[model samples]
Target: MIIDEQWIYCPVCSNKTRIKVRYNAELKNFPLFCPKCKQENLIDAKGFQIIVIKEPDAKTQSR
Candidate 1:
């Protein structure tokens, strides 16, 4: 499905973004990136919810 916008932002960036959805051949996963912070995000096409709030990853949580 084609979308009007094509990028998205990290949760810390107010979740305001419009990222492109693409397949990663290495991980076999669909990944999105934050335009503002340039952070990479993983969003499952089949199960991910729109306007979803992302939790900090293990690395970020440790900080």
Candidate 2:
């Protein structure tokens, strides 16, 4: 199997993150957590860009 990887940066702190993609997987908007800033970021794998989804609220996080 061929695996593809993409490097993503954290918008809040500019932390580098690596994500692996499978050949058959669909590339779409996904949520990622930044370890340094502790924030959820939206990523667009198809466009190779980071998109702003929404800030997670305390209530949603608790669940």
Candidate 3:
């Protein structure tokens, strides 16, 4: 498992953030998270790159 450099939206702040795909050796599933938001995101290590969809004008949204 490897960490991929991917960008996604932060749900809390509605801001763009960098996400990473990490392989969890101890867990059965892969662990994911938003670097900026610090939110836990679940993922499949063997699956393709995950795409995070954001709402319209998400960039302008405030907390």
Candidate 4:
């Protein structure tokens, strides 16, 4: 079992975050929190690629 870490850019704030992905867990969608924008971002790992899924209602400005 090989585990790989990939950097995903947040679509809301363009912040880069790292996510750990496993070979068997490729079909699952991972949730990532952006510290800069304070938004919950989704990471989609399919076809050996990283895709960032942003929620329209999850965007918040930093105080």
- lDDT per residue as tens, model 4, 29-61: 578777788877667777557677655554574
Total clashes, candidate 4? 0
Q: Per-residue lDDT for 1-63 in model 2, tens only?
A: 533545667777888755554434454568877877887777655545456666577887974
Candidates in order have lDDT scores of 0.50, 0.64, 0.47, 0.64
Candidate with best TM-score: 2
Q: Name model 1 segments beyond 4 Å from true.
A: 1-9, 19-28, 45-63
Give every collision pair in model 2: none
Error of 3 at 43 (Å): 0.5
RMSD in angstroms, all models?
A: 6.7, 6.2, 9.8, 7.3
Given candidate 2, what's the lDDT at residue 54? Answer: 65
- In order of appearance, the predictions have TM-scores of 0.36, 0.50, 0.30, 0.48
Which parts of model 4 are misplaced by more than 4 Å? Answer: 1-5, 18-27, 52-63
Across residues 1-63, which tens digit of lDDT does each residue of candidate 1 receive? 744333334555767667543332122244666766877766544212334435566876753
Poorest 10 consecutive residues of model 3 by lDDT? Answer: 21-30
- Model 1 weakest 10-residue run by lDDT: 20-29
How does candidate 3 fare on TM-score? 0.30
The Cα error of candidate 2 at residue 27, in Å, is 3.7
TM-score of candidate 4 relative to the true fold:
0.48
